[model samples]
Target: MTGSSVLSVLCIYVVLTFGSFITVIKSLETQTQSHEHYSYDRVINLPGQPLTPSVSQFSGYITVNKDHGRALFYWFFEAQSHPSKKPLLLWLNGGPGCSSIGYGAAVELGPLKVNKNGGLNFNPHSWNKEANLLFVESPVGVGFSYTNTSSDLDILDDQFVAEDTYNFLVNWLQRYSQWSSHDFYISGESYAGHYVPQLAELIHNRNKDISENPFINLKGFIVGNPETDDSYDYRGILEYAWSHSVIPDEVYDTAKNVCNFENNNWSKECNAAMEIVFDKYKEIDIYNIYAPICLINTTSSVVGSDSHVSSFKRPIRIPAGYDPCYTPYVQEYFNRTDVKKAFHANTSIDYKVCSDHVFNLYNYTISSILPIYTELIKSGLKIWIYSGDADGRVPVIGSRYCIEALGLPLKSPWRSWFHNQQVGGRIVEYEGLTMVTVRGAGHLVPLNKPSEALSLIHSFLSGQPLPKDR
Candidate 1:
């Protein structure tokens, strides 16, 4: 062979050998990752759950306060499809004490639905369709979340709740750092009106102080049927009851006139009027005025509790609709030993849907989250306030009143938004804020109107307007 030809052959051999060396290193690295992917958080299989090969599920604790041994339980479901492309969303349930896993995840928007038979079924409208969903049993003593220091239960307040939640998010990001860059949003309903906004403020404020470690990618928040202002909320409820003929004109007038509706303190007259309102509310589901109140004794066998059976005389019922009593079934499902073990939950503590201790002892530091909302909105966070129109608890009227109080310039006037070629809800947009009312939905909008709820959420995460036509 010629010398030049020999050199060319040597060059070809060197190129091939170097390429093979790089490939081998990459292959070994991939193998190392495959072996090291082991996670204490990895879920093997859930008892009684059907095989879901495509989706990933994780559950366990993130110790937020090590000194107090404070840990929060979390259940996360990767998006049903294209999880990598989806946003990460953390959902909270309000009661200032409700289990997000039990109420928000299982019953409302999670992939699992607690059936009347105490079995699990797929929620066809689960929010995982749009985002990677995480549900935490927040604050100490709620669901599987607990604090070794039992006194942590007694002193729980908005500040503590917000701080703990913020810590959970930050530490959670550290553990699941792959999602640190994903567009993130915090969401909840009811008293989470307090929880969600307060936590968002903390995250936002912390993000601003970049001198300190910041939650750099914190995006925005969405709250539904939130308990924002005691006064506006109460006034809205009274007005809603009268407008819907849920209460008589005289009862409504008394509530409107006698109640301060602007502060936490209530006069005797206000208390009396509220009593009349409560008496009337007993006949129907207060959460969803139009929803069928659960009168069935489904819990006799599984739950072994007669407390769930309503004593109210059955009003003429709608046969085919959302069951207002759906929540009790969820409580029973969570209480099951197998279910708790499968989720890596606190097997020792009996899970209650809403912790009575949390409700009673929880010091509500603020009657209105309006100030927080005002400051956050000014910061240009994507703040969306949505309400289930049929919810009497924190009715649409009240949410609108709170938004109007923000005094933002209107970006979009109130108009009906469509889904599946039908009017799903009405929405109004303002600079850095949007107010929405889901048609026919109750306090739990996703539970009442799942399809519309999914659309609303998909749009929010996509930063697009909700579908306006079929």
Candidate 2:
């Protein structure tokens, strides 16, 4: 054991030890990555079920850029039957914070299931019956969508949402190679007026940039009772209530005089007018006049006695100590052993149902997108805006005001249209765009009137002129 030999042997041992450690680390890393990438224990698979229109339902997550860290958004993809080259419809639900999975899944598009207690029956109006529908829980903190770092909680603007959504779409397309060439249309309601338009613009911008994949095709957008122009929406609500006799003429006049409909500022006079309007309408509850009845909670005297089944739909209930609109139940449902396994989310990080403390402001503005809509028109993308007539929040009048403000040329006069002889809805087609009013429907148009909504979507996707009346 000479000194040089002893040193050489020590170096060899150290190298061997480091090499072995590296091998173990790599193995662990590979296993973890595989779990993250290929894990599918959360998604519920309804194999051979006639409920789904397609043979396969794919669920996965896409990594989008978060302000604080990386964010993951869960998406469910339903393929079209027979595999034609059809456009993809991306559905979003509006809440300044709400889960697309909760509303868009349970209420609108995907197959529905009643609660264990048999509260509601399964609905046959799922949008998946028509087109390939992809519902995404957006931003870092919405729905089951979440981010890894604390800074992700700060996103409350259009820019952050659009960026994250764009990233998610791009990455998601790569994950599901079949959809790479599909034309994408963004659709949503309420706050989605903000989400869908901005997202469409971002996709359009990305498509034009030579550096990015030009193949990411963004076609058009549809918003149902969207909160696009707040001024128009609020003012239109008063007008709609007045026209429908929901509010007295005197009250409407008072509100009109005090409220500045053109300005975005909410004044004390406007607040007073709103109070008066609320007082007037408090006695009369009008939501769905032709929908199913919902069970009323024991706390309120207002039992579900309306003839309309859609009116008085129950506000979603969650377990105690959670926000029903955006909370743990939604995330938990999506992360169900069946749901997780089907969606492959169980293998990644634990799902966060709704982003806790994600957004600070309830309202957001996207001044950038108005011009983008014009650009889209110039580029020949057919745009459509539809409002459910019975909705007070974002009424038909508001949509009309917004479209009028755009100064679009009307190709045809506004008139009633019919799906059969039943008078399906109303339509106002102008140039390449169409504005529709869903009859006997409320804010959640698809939930309240799924057939009408689906028909409108089908018409829009086909690039045919919107029918005059339904």
Candidate 3:
């Protein structure tokens, strides 16, 4: 070998040796911090709830901004088995203001369900059985996440949410470094379509920029009933409604003529035509047209009142096992002084299923997140979009349109996917994307069809197609 080549080889060896030393030191420091956090955030008891069906869960705040007292709340559950070897999956629920805690954790995929008596029950079908799960109420204005800077609430947008969420993940990883090298996936439903992809793109781009150890090994992302392309979302909403007879044909016809959904602009005629849809939805729960609206009286501030709990009445659909009146119970449970104290949540802050302030002022800056999806897909990120076909709010129709707009080649034709000896749903795979539909499910697929949702998650994480056989 030449003298110069020999010298370069020696330099690389020295750098590698030194890098290993630094990583060891870093690992020790991160582990110490993680241990400290474990003690602080470990959930001792959920009021009136039984022991978790599995390992353990923790909930608390991770300060994203100390200067502004801006902290995001998180509920973390370890995998049921082999947590150290399992992937770390972050779950987000989108209302632009929804609580991942109230919705995703408590009602949807969480192992804990708040009961009618303001108690908690163990959910057997939680996603944690497959992967370590984490849920965050993001952007510092929703759920237990809060900020002292009131002005921060006013400027909430997609970029703001993504940046804050990213900050939380980085800090959180350092505090739980054992999972730093594990595969990580972000999944959510509803408005999270925007939140999920936007955050994944940010992380993917940031990972490319990062040359050091603080990298999040983001494997893929999945979103259900997501609000993707605004144009497509609107079109899908109208089409799904009309096809399902939620609105009259004449009204749908008028809307098509007057509304420029492609650009999200509407005329006076368009507004009037669309009102028919809003009016019709009032007669039904728009999220799940077939699901009954919550008839229980939650109007009174009487917290935990059993007065509204009526005699046993079977739910319209038994498969989902979600109550229309459930959110109120969640509200009652989380808002309790004892529960907040146990959760390490701020007693002063009022918990909400969705923050109207954040929702109203949430500056939705993007017209379409399809561009972000295309970029991530090309970057080789596994992308999947699952839709609860019955969700009128963000139906499968919009998701299909959004996927088609990407112009990816079909990898597989649509086929039935089974769960519990029945056809659970359908899946259509693309070159780098997969579209899934949960039959008879609404906005929250996991809540409506837990078994099917669990089955879908299993397939996605394993990088396998949904089971074709029994």
lDDT for 469 in candidate 2 is 45
RMSD of each: 8.7, 9.5, 7.1
Between candidates 2 and 3, the one scoring higher on TM-score is 3
lDDT of 3: 0.82
**Once model 2 is optimally superposed onto the true structure by TM-score, how far is the C-alpha of residue 103 displaced, in angstroms?**
0.7
TM-scores of the candidates are: 0.86, 0.76, 0.89
2 or 3, which is superior by lDDT?
Answer: 3
Candidate with the larger TM-score of 1 and 2: 1
Worst 10 residues of 1 by lDDT: 311-320
How well is each residue in 224-292 modelled by candidate 1, as lDDT tens digits? 988888778778878888898999988887778887767566677777777677667667777777876
Error (Å) of candidate 3 at residue 336 is 1.0
Q: Whose TM-score is greatest here?
A: 3
lDDT of each: 0.79, 0.63, 0.82
lDDT of 3 by residue, 301-333 (tens): 112112112210100111122467787788889
Error of 3 at 298 (Å): 3.0
All candidates in order of TM-score, best leading? 3, 1, 2
Clashes of 2: 33
Q: Sorted by lDDT, highest first, which candidate order results?
A: 3, 1, 2
- Which regions of candidate 1 deviate over 4 angstroms? 1-38, 297-321
Where model 3 places Cα greater than 4 Å from the true spot, the runs are: 1-30, 52-54, 299-321
